[model samples]
Target: MAARKIHTLIVGAGQAGIAMSEHLSAVQLPHLVLEKARIAEAWRSHRWDSLVANGPAWHDRFPGLAFPDTDPDAFVAKDKVADYFEAYAAQIKAPVRCGVEVLKVERGPGGRGFRIDTTDGLYEADNVVVATGAFQKPLIPQVIPADAGFLQLHSSQYRNPDQLPDGGVLVVGAGSSGVQIADELNQAGRKVYLAVGPHDRPPRSYRGRDFVWWLGVLGKWDLQTPAAGAEHVTIAVSGAQGGRTIDFRRLAGEGITLVGRSGAYQNGHMAFADDLARNLDRGDANYLSLLREADAYIARHGLDLPPEPEAHVIIADPECVSRPVRDLDLRAAGIGTVIWAVGFERDYSWLEVDAFDAAGKPVHQRGVSKEPGIYFLGLPWQSRRGSSFIWGVWYDARHVADQIVTQGRYTAYDQSARARQAAPESAIHAAAGDPDGPYPHPHL
Candidate 1:
């Protein structure tokens, strides 16, 4: 069958895809957004029921659409976030096809464009934009024993305390997701064990203003490098009850047992690292660094702002920090549930292109792929540290759309020589699905 040709074909109808569609529409470009599931599927299905956006509503607005003035400072709930995307799509009349999953994307005939094989049908596009945001796949360490007799769940599958078994729960990785889930489980009368990892514990509010406001004012949000923004660790804060800080020490005091990083699980025994104090110290250092930078920025700008508030005192138990459990028997400890909040993996296996790096990550500068007529949006550090967030998509999307408009339509062979010269054989092999390649399927 003949493929339906399009000027630009965008994959994933999440925030990034929707934002890209809006920009393309503004420029009067012909484009269509194809989503594997419904629009905002991740927010609607993947997130927990009680999950609220880590950022406030005011900071979550996309281009040409602002959150209703009802509660700009409020943290939008999962359902509300999905609704916002739906409403934005309606308002913009975005051309989005939900439930259309792209199975594979390869060089089109004669390398003139891309041939996209989707569940519905084939699509030929002069240009293609991958707008699938970060966090494509849930990452569970391989060290976790599959036979470990416990109800294991990743943060993506965890919904509420009631959904878990009626027993103690061990929440691994003390990032935003881990801490929040631990807090919720503890509040629901479940004995909670939090495996603390290296994480930032920034205050929810500083100097009578939300921390987000400080980040924006201090130019933290504008940081181009991921290193400067401390993108490694998730921001530990909550939007529940307006906004509140998430302190490990506070959770520990509230009867939540804190352990060190997880190591391995074998023979019904889970091993944990004994670097809790060191990790906490590192997090404290990062927090101080950010505060100092913010303070310096305020002084440099000579902005009239209130003095920084005193740091909150969180008393930690020495026993909790010193006690080392090299191996823990889950069944003996009565821990029936294990929640892995470790991290996420990005997958671009469907994209058959030579514009990937040794790590299987796309090689792009400010959202424009090295390969002509291809682009990526909504990736962390794609252009700025905020690139993966809702508020950040607009900037990257606009840049990508502009690139498409400037480059016009062309075949892949036009730049095949340059791509071959620039990209390594390993990247090409990985993209072409060489079984012996460094990056195999299901991971990338």
Candidate 2:
């Protein structure tokens, strides 16, 4: 006889999974969370020791829990954040099977539910949620020449400055991670170079208030409404601002050298783009101008704001090489480390659903997909500003969880086989290009 089927199966056991589990328990929904590793694996394994969330602690809590800290503006370190997740999972007694990797999911035969095959075992569920976040894949550009002799590592593998070779270090991305790592390494007495890019810029503090406070004030943290339709659009556009995050202006003001986008490794020296330094300087100027404009607008709106804070307190070291990689030979120059602070990519090979549109993202309004009993969370822009953050997932999770309870009951999803058969072939045909195309079409 076939094994008993589960009611719901949620992929991943991180913050998003916990949020979904909390809601499922409240509604007494039968479900289980499948995690390939221990809970908070990414936080535990990938992040550096001194790393704290760029956002404040209060803004980092998941659903149904709060981060206890005397200083609201305090940055919660990586280990602490990991512990918080573990505690949250334990507190809720979330139904999770750790170390269980889900390899595939497909529509069940007869359309009753779904067939989920994992590394550990196989199971079926009426509904499934791919809560795995977009960070599953690390992205590196192929444009960089392969012959660059320097050792290159993604930020994921970086723990501290001690791993660098005897020579200087070159960081290839100037995003939040890149900037922070560059600062840390530079402080550790290693020669560091930062490659700058166009990133969102905000102040460390604005009007004597933490950046997160403005987010709350701006209703960026509001999640009472189910994010669907236009509300979703509003959230995306607003959140893309990175919550007006604090930039590295203060650091740069202290004399850190910033370069441009392109870099090549040659005889022991890293060569940067011809326009890298100039572009970086221009970008920095543009960023300051934008902030000043916002400040001016605030004053114009008759807002009683305190005097503007002085510019940044720290600056990077100035004793840096000037030539680009093409001009300098990296191997001969003995540059030991190359840090790829490049961004992440989204991978969804395990999901066996027809919901994804072009570019391999599930087509969902809010968290619900066109396929019944299917949902997603922790996406880059699931609904609003906080969708991807720990705190943000709570709102999206609650909405998606409630949706599952309301639409995922056994009776609600009990489509009759005959009715499913009579349905048009259009639905299944649309999935033809999908790797898990609805072959033997299970319609119910």
Candidate 3:
């Protein structure tokens, strides 16, 4: 294939990339998106078959579009969510080329722009936006031996309970994915053992409103990253069974054994951290904090939302999980599979740029990197806490698009184009200095 030049090039066609494409197309910016797989491939292929989105459809969709023929409060099934992305791309007429795998991104000839080498052909672009997102590589710890008799799989590789071997299953990690899988497997009549860890236990719905709405109304969604050393954690909310709070005590009551964090696995015996009770206490505290904050907000604002008498009531921990259980022999317990629902990290091996630090993480203020003409999207805490959600990506992408459109020579080109077209998208510039400070230094 012959080489070509494009004004802007975006990698990855997931929600983040698609949202970026939407904003770029708004100002008639010439750009194209290159995707290694089909649009929203993560939702279509990677997620478990029985999985539904963690948030309600109403709050989870991009602003310009809504889930078709679905209730706003309903948690959308995984495949339908993927369909929504595909439909959105078609609706916006996003310039996407699927199956074009980008291999490397290096400086263009004469150091002018970026040269992207792909499986299809080579191309040059004046600007590049890396939108592959933060969930690039699965982090599977080396606790279990490679030659271990039990089958091990990362949560990304898991499809359903049927995919696991016939025996007890141990699910490590207590995040959203871990709890959901454990619940699914338990419902299938499989003996499931879950390993608990640090997590937020916010109720899915409180006082007749979804927790998501409460976050936005209470202004918790716009939270910035805490000063370094406060480890980032995720909420353990679930949308299964019509969405509700996650309680380990209740799960233990239902016959699923809850254990502490997983440790070493040697000679068929698996060790665990003796912190299950402490982890539960931490989650309980987070849950109570939200309830109290909601009450205070309601009183201060004089809102007419209903109140529950038992909103602040937390049940006692079940006896089985009140204290950490000691080590158990995997073979004796008949545990045949281990699902590592730990987490993921970003992979920038293909990115040949100097915008990263010694830790291999991107060094950027907001989405704008230190390297000129390069940007990133779909990163956690990119702008705020909401940056990880679908609706949040809208604002982050808009900001990046603003910086790109108002960039060096492109500003002049954009001004002339707007004059000729007789429609100026001046709002992008107007909000550049808005007080929320989602992007502290747009120029930087």
Best by lDDT: 3
Report the C-alpha displacement of residue 306, candidate 1, in angstroms.
4.7
Per-candidate TM equals 0.88, 0.78, 0.91
Q: Compute the lDDT of residue 398 as modeled in candidate 2.
A: 81
**Candidate with maximal TM-score:** 3
Looking at model 1, report the run of 10 residues with the lowest lDDT sum: 435-444
Kindly report which residue pairs in candidate 1 clash with one another. Answer: 111-412, 112-411, 347-444, 348-444
lDDT of 1 by residue, 85-169 (tens): 9899999999999889999998888977899999999999988999887788998777756676688899999999889978999
Q: Where does candidate 3 stray beyond 4 Å?
A: 227-229, 410-444
Candidate 3 residue lDDT tens string, 1-444: 767899899999999999999999997789999999999999988888888988999999999899999999999999998899999999999999999999999988887789999988999998999999999999889988878888999998999888988999989998999999998999998888899887788878888889998899988899988435435665699898889789878788887888888888788899888988888888898888888898898899998989976767777777767655769788788889999999897799999988899998998878998888899999999999899888998899999998887684454555544654564457555544568532333254
Model 1 CA deviation exceeding 4 Å by range: 228-231, 295-309, 312-318, 409-444
- Evaluated at residue 193, the lDDT of candidate 3 is 87
- Candidate 3: what lDDT? 0.87
Give the 10-residue window scoring lowest on summed lDDT in candidate 2: 232-241
Q: How do all the candidates rank in terms of lDDT, highest first?
A: 3, 1, 2
TM-score-sorted candidate list, best first: 3, 1, 2
